[model samples]
Target: MPKQKGNLWTTMWISYLETCLNNYLYSGIWFQQFQKIIIPHSQSSLMTKRLVAYFLINKVLEETIRGDYCKNKNIQEQADPTLIPKTIITLNQVEASKFSYIVGWMLFKLIKRDYLMNSHPKFSVICILLRSLCTEKVEYDVLETKLQTTIIISRSEFVQFMYRLESLVIELFEKHNELGSNILRYVENSFLTNLHLNQTFIQILKSSNGENNSELENEDCKFIYERCVLIYMKSRQKTWRSVNNYIPKKGTASL
Candidate 1:
């Protein structure tokens, strides 16, 4: 049994080396000096299991954007703005969920750095990108906490963030009306499918001690809800027809 365990460890070591060689070979780096490590004792079961694990991790990476941003904690308050270029590329390659998280974290770091440096324009283009990345059903604890912190860093900074965010919403709506509608529909479907959105909203309202800002409640809220219900009806025609006829039109709520 001890010998068998040793062999397994040996295989793991060999696997890591192979992974490195695979990368180097593809890059054509150090090819001439590289000595090939032969798999003398092939262990199919072990290799297959590890391969499966790799695939799962890779899927998460692709779905979660390789976790590059979170993995590299070297991001400093005074880091180069040039990092945005790499971040953009990484975001484009990540899966939607992973990408959203990465964008959120990056925005948090930017806000933190900006606060430390006393920058007026903390809510820059990158900050806008962060909010845009937030899905209608976003639930990142880190993001929510940081968002509250950033907003409270100073009254003026909070106001600026809200103002900039409002501008961003308007700009996005104007720039991509059709696309925005579709995206909203998608978000609504997710809410309905999960059976948690309405409940969550209720909780939020309750937590506000019923003093929920009536100011933020506007025609847009009604429009958003109606749009979601309409989209829901379309997809669930047969299942929801009876209730669909009872749904209120735009600018009204039924509940």
Candidate 2:
């Protein structure tokens, strides 16, 4: 087995992208330019290439946020304990904005495209990226029937963000499109890996299997219900309910 196949391929991919963009890789703005170029070109390119762009963006985010953590032992030693990866995040405000802008746009597109009916590995990684934003350590707090671990993000931030995410699931599930098994696998693994600390999420995953109905709507509802439970778990009051009472309101939510 060759040891360097992955890294060597990545090196070549970066070189390939640099040539196409006619620009050397810089830090923040380079991702913006990459996204801009891809949007129009994507319609005519293979879907697999568009998915590769997701992985590329995620890798770029890791590089910008972790800085030299992988290469420098000193940075790893100095990382914040509260951070799961235990590395310094973002080189500066400019770097942080770049991360946010790209990630937020991807979520918006995923909502629009329904991932073109395919699961993306980087979609789960996107959830992990949001976890990086919490500045404080989590604690065990009791809510109603059981003790709960506060999420990696703060109560206010987590609730607000998940509420918006719930809306995304609602929008997508409402489409009644037949979701591919790959997408379901990614969604399940995302909750199991990144959100296993929350017992409710685990329960939702377990319950989904006992479901007998094979209808597409029922399957979609499983994930939609999971998001709703997640929002409930993150709520400060430990319960959540909302009505769409929109009269003059129509806009998108951003991270």
Candidate 3:
């Protein structure tokens, strides 16, 4: 890794970012700065350096929102339980935008861990929203189901967002079900690790699977059907009607 030719703060910000993200420390000094930090020049970029600092802090809390409780004891002691990680990240609005990718990537990496995936909603929503906003086109797999890609926010929090995610999901799912379902279904399945709690979502899925046939229009629906089948098979003994009946002979569904 080549050294970055920058002042104290610029170097400090880059070092702290690398430390927090656990990535290569000194590689791609030019491109990483351009892509990740939005820093272009090296001479007395104090404003840019401070922005980087803000980005790193927000990225840390945002990516590991739920885990922050266990990880940042000082932050935990200082914060109110009701305050979500999303709120904290957006508090410094300007800096947060600059570090969006870092925050998003952190959340992505965290949700891949099952224990972390099942841990808390704070982290879950961060993952879901980030993916939804950032990843426009991607493939769906068991990894999506296993990971905590969606927040599965409580009804109470849902009303307060000043914007409803369900409406957003419906709109996005309607337009881009493949990507939407890829993100939404993960939220549906893993948001509440306890399947019993998400009875409403399960029913919505059950109804979709119960009636739909091989002529599926939305890719999200297909992904959701596949995920529901797996979740049902894993947690409950019964098989979903969507899998056993609707799926064609070419495909197979199992736990």
TM-scores of the candidates are 0.16, 0.21, 0.18
Which lDDT tens digits does candidate 1 get at residues 47-104? 5644554565456555564344333322212222111111112113344344234334
Q: Model 2, 113-207: lDDT tens per residue?
A: 34432263333433333333333334655567466543232333433344343333233222122331122222223333343223333343333
Question: Which of the two, 2 or 3, has more lDDT?
Answer: 2
Ordered list by TM-score, greatest first: 2, 3, 1
Candidate 1 ranges with C-alpha deviation above 4 Å: 1-195, 205-212, 216-255
Q: What is the C-alpha RMSD of each candidate to the true structure, in Å?
A: 22.2, 21.8, 22.0
Which of 2 and 3 is the better model by TM-score? 2
Which rank order by lDDT, best down to worst? Answer: 2, 3, 1
Q: What is the lDDT of residue 32 in candidate 2?
A: 56
Which scores higher on lDDT, 1 or 2? 2
Q: TM-score for model 3? A: 0.18
lDDT of 2 at 126: 32
Give one clash count per candidate, in the order shown.
Answer: 1, 0, 1
